[model samples]
Target: RLFAEKITGTRRDRPELARLLDHLRSGDVVTVTRLDRLARSTCDLLDIAEQIQAAGAGLRSLAEPWADTTSPAGRMVLTVFAGIAEFERSLIIDRTRSGRQAAKAKGVKFGPPPTLTPEQITHARALVDQEGRTVKEAAALLGVHRSTLYRAFNKQEPTP
Candidate 1:
């Protein structure tokens, strides 16, 4: 049996998992302590399990007590649990949507703050115009990137 015991915060990145995954073959059984230990996100959990199943292996969560791909009953139970998890995720999404709507009604804009100030923009433009530096060089002097300079100049062109 593949024993997946609880991993601590220190091991959350799980550098060793790739090695285990690379070695796992068809008809192999992967056992883990719990679903939470299996994945930090529901989507990730499903993705990992899908990868295992695609390899012709099965996953068993010891803590879940019913997650077994080896038998029909186990598969049925897992399906029900997956449905429940999906429903829960949907509910969260709906609530988030409503909350965002309410926030938008209040004129709340959610996202990162603007990186450059008006003064910085004017300075960058002045430097580019006065200095013999190219756009890339100007961006380098300003500690930004060429893409940033292009955006500031409104020179967006579709890249192939």
Candidate 2:
């Protein structure tokens, strides 16, 4: 039986992979094009291997001779690769988090900038509240959308 999943291997619950696991039987060999295609993490790979073994089945990787779970040496090599994959994943996560922290420390802001300036918002609020100008009129005069002006005006309100 052949099962295919387009989901990333890093995800824990890939539907096709789960189906394949469920359908596995004794002596069945689950084959993949590559070890990376099967799992992105060592723990996940090891867990899947254990599950296959429990089902009296084995796993094979077409690209990696060392990924044959039916042989002792292949299992050992796969174990080593799993450790390396986990270490590599940890290093990548650390680098990404550090880069984000550095960017934040440097005052780098994410997402779109405010649509209206502080002065423009103050003027819009005054036109709407003090002069009793409609939101549409204030927004048209300030060259902004009525919804944008409305949101800004609501946020700027003083508590009673």
Candidate 3:
């Protein structure tokens, strides 16, 4: 009997589940207390069910009778659920993309703030270019890594 009770249902890296699937043979039935106990999401559930079917094994959920993959009707229901899940995921992706675009239009930044300001970058560049100070020395004066100073220098336009 494979048990993954300690692992959270949201995690996909259950060792016991992997072992059970790996050892499954033809005509084997993998019984679970519930469908949620076996998979994190509908997509994950369908993927595991597909693997079981491919191995000629079936899945049966004690709490969800309709989840049995050994019967024709059960297979049909799961297939329909898979289609719905796919459609829902696509809709979510589209909505997220639209929302991100809207946020960008409003001048909302997504990632972390810049490490150094334009003034600091200009000062660092002047120390390196005009004073002939080493990149390392300039970065040390600016209280930043040489690479950070270098990145700042690269991003700004070269002085005429």
Q: What C-alpha lDDT values do all the predictions have? A: 0.73, 0.85, 0.90
Segments of candidate 1 deviating more than 4 angstroms: 1-12, 115-160
Runs in model 3 deviating more than 4 A are 2-4
Clashes of 1: 1
| Candidate 2 to native Cα RMSD, angstroms | 5.6
Across 21-92, the per-residue lDDT of candidate 1 in tens digits comes to 777799898888777777777666766777787888888878887777767787787677678889998999
Error of 2 at 92 (Å): 1.7
Tens-digit per-residue lDDT, 1-160, candidate 2: 8888989888877999999989999999999998778877667788788899899999999998878988899878877876887889899999999999999999999789988988888887778778999999999987888999878867775523
Off by over 4 Å in 2: 2-22, 33-57, 131-160
Ten residues in a row with the worst lDDT in model 2? 151-160
The residue-by-residue lDDT of candidate 3 on 1-160, one tens digit each, is 6656577878867877888888999999999988988889899999999999999999999999998889998899999999999999999999999999999999999998998999998888888889999999998998889999888889999876
> In model 3, what is the error at residue 77, expressed in angstroms?
1.6
lDDT of 3 at 151: 88
Ordered list by lDDT, greatest first: 3, 2, 1
The estimated TM-scores of all candidates read: 0.61, 0.54, 0.87
Which prediction has the highest TM-score against the true structure? Answer: 3
Global Cα lDDT for candidate 2: 0.85
> At residue 10, what lDDT does model 2 achieve?
82
